[model samples]
Target: MPAVTTKFNEDDTLDMEMFEVNIKAQLDAGVSGIILGGTLGKASTLTGEEKQQLIRETVKMVAGAVPVIINIAEQTTKAAIEAARVAKECGARGLMILPPMRYKANDYETVTYVKAIANSTDLPIMIYNNPVDYGIEVTLDMFEEMLECKNIEAVKESTRDISNITRIKARFGDRLKVFTGVDTLGMESILMGADGWVAGLVCAFPAETCTIYELSKVGKMAEALEIYRWFLPILELDINPQLAQNIKMAEVATGIGTEHVRAPRLPLIGAERERVAKIISDGLAKRPNLPAYKGLSMA
Candidate 1:
């Protein structure tokens, strides 16, 4: 697969029109596939019905141009199963699932969490592992257990621990597709045998990310690093869990999407917006030689 990019949200709100535009733009920019309702899409705030609507609209708009993966995250396994069923019925190409958030589950409970969603649908499942947010890490042994679940075919690795990725690739390279969830690690992860990348910064600079991915794929390390340096500032913002909000702000400043996130997310404003805008502006200014910099005039 090329690389899976997410649909950038405005604030935490779902603007179907803007979401469609973002997806179409990423596809045109050369992403391998699209992952809707993932972290960047603020899946938590969306109701089950809203998520179904998001999936149906995304599928309709994509028109099979690329695979669309819907994220099914809920407080309960039953709710996740229902959401997964709806995702399949709405024409999603696959499903990405995060572990239950409110309560920390032990290894056995975690296995059940993953199994419930995997068994709920025949669509291939990509287990989303973000330890910082979930307070639980699906250990290698847990992953081994998950393999028995027929639909669990991939993993969106977000821990940034290279060793874990190395071990997973060495052990189950044949059975699972490993995709890096961190944007800054895109090149390195791909170089380390990751099947693909699920990127958030791609929302701000899809064309730039496409360039980096292409360069890395072609063994153009020097060139890829040159582009990667320009992305570091924005990537720094993503280190926090508030990446969804930061990405949306960058999108607004860059004319990619609206900056209208929903409640509890507290849309960036005042100093926060100013700081984010300055970072983006400075990053663009520093990379005068980049195509994205030149394209800023067009934007």
Candidate 2:
């Protein structure tokens, strides 16, 4: 799952009790791995100490049962390397790193920025390539420069360009694993040969998400499409600017998360809140019992 962040008390402090329970829920439901402080995790507002605390607690809760990837969204090359070092020190198994934050770094600077962070830690890196949301696009040409960074092993393709899935496989082949970062495109990406998914609505529908992936991978396209069609409305929740609030609300409706957010982000209000709640409700009311897959677990 593109894991959600820790719940907060009304005072905006971490609700450690709810947070631990939420972690156990996802693991029990069979999410392959977890992302701590992703975009949906609201990494922008999380403090340095909070990030460390989040990682340490998650590593303990998971107990190496799954890989926990901490996101690095620092603004400068130096800070990026430092944050990478910090994630490594805190026991993160991998990182989902964005390009330089705030000021748009040009090609040369972006390439060196990734190299600096990769050199700082031995942990495998998944490059976050969502030009639609993050401005700087990590094109195939830019990736050519990144080939030297062998530790960089995957790409989170939120470019919303599904064709890039084939392009990357055609070009780099198995050198990099490609994950569909957009929830709406998860099944299509898998069917098109993308390696996996880094999803948001999975915060609310973990089993369905895992089932869809496994079905598509196993050539049960008919079964996969049934779930995907029912899922399109809920999947739409992950693509908007209010994604943090939207996904959190879905989690609440499903009894897995809360809508509380830190400053600069408020809980949904008025019609927006009701509208999202309706979508979650409708999806759950008609939720399907996915067929059991005896294959190796997607998780």
Candidate 3:
């Protein structure tokens, strides 16, 4: 699953042309799903109507080839439930939801918020446990409380603690799917048994990112590592505060996207643009000739 960037026109309108192009690349790369309107998608700046439109169009374009998931990051439980409702109504196959965005809710509040959204819609849910950036860790205990909700099927493990994969498996077994949300740690996490990758830099380099996951899952570590090592510098861009600009710039390099971003967020300028440009160029110049891996076997 790629946490794909939402393409925008220079006028700040949705860039469906480029958006479809990137989505096609990901599907061709053998990704299991397409995740829209996440952090990488600039969900914060998107209007409710725009989000619904995105979900509807992506669902249509995907046409059940793979699941189309919508990210729900609302400030209130009521609004969150509404987001869920919209996702389902617009034909999203699943939802990747964050905890309350406005308030730093405690464990009880957070649990209630997540469960409320889960119960409101029949769509399968993947909780975004990105405390490193989002500031509230969904601990094992909290997951225990949430386990009874059958729709809460997966967790995007963004805690950056590799051990948490072991911990989740130890505590929940196969009850909950685990997907690494960090781009740099994708190979390690999959090797440690993460079910999938909710990737970032994948927006720019879909085949390389998916190839790493597929190779790692099949124990082809040496081949995977070669690409992963080359991919590291580009992956690091995903961790930066200006990741949207950095990755979108890379999309431009790959000819799959544009540099346009929404208001309050500007395109990369001067030194930052030059620095990221060098990384993208270097990575592409040395881009590995991926081995003829046997099968897709996507994570």
Q: What are the lDDT scores of the predictions, listed in order?
A: 0.77, 0.87, 0.91
Candidate 1 residue-wise lDDT, 105-126, digit = tens: 8889989889978877789999
The TM-score values for the models, in the order shown, are 0.90, 0.96, 0.98
Off by over 4 Å in 1: 1-13, 287-299
* Structural RMSD, model 1: 4.7
Query: How well does candidate 1 match the true structure in TM-score terms?
Result: 0.90
Count of clashes, each model: 6, 0, 0
**Per-residue accuracy of model 2 over 156-227 as CA lDDT, tens digit each:** 999999999999999999998999998989998998899989988888777788888878888888988999
What's the candidate order when arranged by decreasing TM-score? Answer: 3, 2, 1
Candidates 2 and 3 compared: the better one by lDDT is 3
- List the candidate 2 regions with Cα displacement exceeding 4 Å: 294-299
Candidate 1 residue-wise lDDT at 251: 77
Best by TM-score: 3
Q: Which of 1 and 2 is ahead in lDDT?
A: 2
Write the residue-wise lDDT of candidate 3 on 23-64 in tens digits.
Answer: 999888888999999998988999999999899999888889
Query: Top model by lDDT, which number?
Result: 3
